[model samples]
Target: MVVLRTGPVAVGGVTLGNHLILAAGVLGTTGASLSRMLARGAGGVVTKSIGPEPKNGHAGPCVAVLDNGILNAMGLPNPSQDFTGELGSLGQKPVIVSIFGGTPEEFAEVAGWFKGTAAGFELNLSCPHAEGYGAAIGVDPVLVEACTRAVSTLGMPTWVKLTPNVTDITAIGKAAERGGATAIVAINTVKAMRISTALRRPVLGNRYGGLSGDAIFPVAVRCVYELFESCKIPIIGCGGVSTADKVVEMMMAGAQAVEIGSAVQRDIGIFETITNELYAKKGIEPGEIVGCAHE
Candidate 1:
């Protein structure tokens, strides 16, 4: 694959090859996969969310494809500390480890395991379907701050992923900032569900899942816009971001960088494609457009 360059971007204290990052859980399960994304075009890659223990994730039918997006209740399946071995060949590529846990101590312990190997840590405080974790603890401002503090204290570039399921996303963004986060990732998947008309039951095994992809792009932009107004920290925008136009729009809404997930399922070369288009249409650096809409 030809290396597509759109100039480097610095977010959450780390320099990226470009502004396009592979969101957590999209081909992020293995070190080889994460490295592959970077090799293909992503400026950075976030490993799938890891917890305190190994998990099998949700049962069958955990993912349901939609016309506009994807709904999944994978339950945060991960190998925990055992996954560390896969990082051996990743080299110095910008690999951000995505982690989650039930408490501050748990979150800190999980981050501690890979502090030496990862370029940074993206706290997965926004997984909506997982029980006793993710949105379960993420919705509260107090816990969000505590969890962020627990991991931020580790001295790594800490980026906190926020849930859009909340009443006020800026509140959580502020909490993450108050906890000393290096940056804040806005707008995780929206909480949603689908009933199988033919099967006469819920499509997802968990009866609920997080909705991601084009459907949530507007919501993600709104959240980023709000965070940019309310917080002083850099914001990494996620949710429904796919095209180069969308990336530009997101940055205009206040995101310094953008993460793409579900869109990759359709085209694995999305990062390179987007970067090419981005530079083709807009010759200037991405930073110049950050929050341009606000002006």
Candidate 2:
């Protein structure tokens, strides 16, 4: 299959085969996994979030399955320096490297590893489970802007992933815009946890985790709608988007693209399914419906 299939998508100065991108942290741990998703019909893929150093992440029981969604606290584990080798197999593919750091300098340092190699960068400013990085630095507008600006200066299409744990997501979205971000990825998993009744303790080993799946779809839509109203940059809607209908709904809410994570866990061929379903249901392009709800 072609690595970069021509399409109508041009979000954040990046061209993709389609609007359905594989979200970070799912089947993105290696070059093979990333390429598998692309072969399965995903427009592109975001690698699992990497950092300045290798991280083993938290203890066991990192994931808890709920009726409505999945709660996970993966802690953003990655090989860090070793991640560069994984990219050799993905040459010319629209692969955006997801990165995180505790500070602006660290963020810049991590992103610099992929300079001229990655199609773009998705700053992990929104991961709720990661303490020093992720939401810890993302909740504040100042840090978001600083981290974004640091990476933006490297001359790559930078997309800041925002956390929904905050009261106002648009504030952070605007901050990314002010920092010269090419696009804003709205609503990472919602901060949440589940208590085990039989064990009488938290289900996750981390005690807290971010919730994602069908349940958070509405929350994601709301965040995208809000961010659309405030930020001029392209918006990538992420969170429980699983179906063709959800993709359209996300676009209507102002998302130029959508990321599928939990659904991919259920079915690796989901991208192909949604692509056929989307084309069948009127063959609408991504640009035509983005922010349609505003009208």
Candidate 3:
């Protein structure tokens, strides 16, 4: 049996077993998958961003593997499923449902559907490639605040996921805080694209996609740092975190919790590896290192 070390870390008033969380859009579409992650030692899970209505996403050739990372124009594909029902299936594990929409009313409507079941809601105002969704709403502080306000009234902790594609991320973070968000998830995937050499055409069917993986680690840290400086709420750092060292680095950069996404795709057991490493090698609890670097 694995003797997991326990370190309590609180985000948005909800306490988690540790600081390591599963990022949105990776390995958390269903309750079963989330259960698997919980068994693997993940502190919590954030489901893939679901819209008000079902989205078919984009066509084939949506993902392109780059030298340093991966680009995907998934277009936020998701089936019309009951999000609250899925959250209930995760048992006692904390689950934050990621929701998206084109308008503030749409965002509120979707969030209302899952109000009581979720531990919290992540307002995905910052996906770069999705049309009428994601970054389109995220870049404008007015829209970000409006969307956040619409969901904040649901009586659940709300986190606004911000996009790095903007010129000033702190402005967006402040806007989210002003709208009553409990926390801000700094730095979603960066906007980028690639072309297929053989076909001499855009790689993704959508012509562009969000870049994720190791390449975005620094950018993520920067955003987290800036948000921490500007906003009073907690910050959840996510980008290309695959190792315990990266987790620590993110916390030092001022993230109360770090979300793992692309790294899990390479190895499902990464959560265990990171937690074990933090205990054995560093001899420091995960919560102990939150914002250590700033001091």
Candidate 4:
């Protein structure tokens, strides 16, 4: 076992072995996949957003690789089974289950199903392309607060993932905090689309998709900084994080921990690589750099 000495960072009171979290909706579906990421040095894993029932997601051609980033409209697909069994098998690694629903009650019900199985819950309130869920619920502060309050009752730490599509993300972040969220994951993918020049139609099956990767890193950093200023809760930055320098940048931008999703597709070994680079180049731990930019 190549134990990474990257030090510890906490989010929503769950103490992670390190600050590198496998972003939700990435390579974290089955227990085997989760274990694989852990073995590769991910400090924790966030499962794909699972709803009350199984979701087939969008149709064909759901993902597109762009010059600057990746566009995806997966529609939050997942097996509609109780994932507690799979979560329980992951041993001591912190597993943060990401969930979504159309209403606060529904969100609570889905969270209840995973009650003793996960270290925390990340409310997938900001998936831009999912209808009747995700950004639709996340864009409204009232709904955001209601969902946060409902899920917080599950007796596990709850982190609300907010959307950058709103005029002021901090408003949503504040609402999440007000509703008892333990932490806030700032900035989900941005709403975007790509038109196929050859086909003369939208490339994504959903017609619209969320843009991720290096294209949104600056936006994510800004959201984290603003949310940290307005809310007292810890912030988990998620956007276009791909390198150790970007990780440090996010920490300086007030993110206690950072999530890398699309970047993992480009390099599965990114976790170990970033941690090693952080330690070797700066002699600084992620925990040591949290909010350093504000000082």
How many clashes (backbone atoms < 3 Å, residues ≥3 apart in a chain or on different chains) does model 1 have? 1
The list of candidate 3 runs beyond 4 A from truth reads 1-5, 280-282, 285-288
- Candidate 4 lDDT over 10-40, as tens digits, reads 7786878688899998887888898899888
Give Cα distance to truth, residue 122, candidate 1, Å: 0.5
TM-scores, all candidates, are 0.97, 0.96, 0.94, 0.95
Q: After superposition, how far is residue 119 of candidate 3 from its true place, in Å?
A: 0.7
**Cα RMSDs, all models:** 2.6, 3.2, 2.8, 2.8
Residue-pair clashes, model 4: 0
- What's the CA RMSD of model 4 in angstroms? 2.8
lDDT of 2 by residue, 1-295 (tens): 1122236577897888889999999999999999999999998899999999999999979998888889999999899979999999888899999999999999999999999889999999989988888999999999999999999999999999999999888899999999999999977899998888999999999999999999999999999999999988899999999998898899889998899999987888999988877764345444667798999
Q: Residue 193, candidate 4: how far off, in angstroms?
A: 0.5
Misplaced by over 4 Å in model 1 are: 1-5, 280-282
Q: Estimate the lDDT of model 4.
A: 0.87
- Model 3 has an lDDT value of 0.86
Which regions of candidate 2 deviate over 4 angstroms? 1-8, 280-282
Order the candidates by lDDT, highest first — what do you get? 1, 2, 4, 3
**Distance from true position, residue 72, model 1, in Å?**
0.4
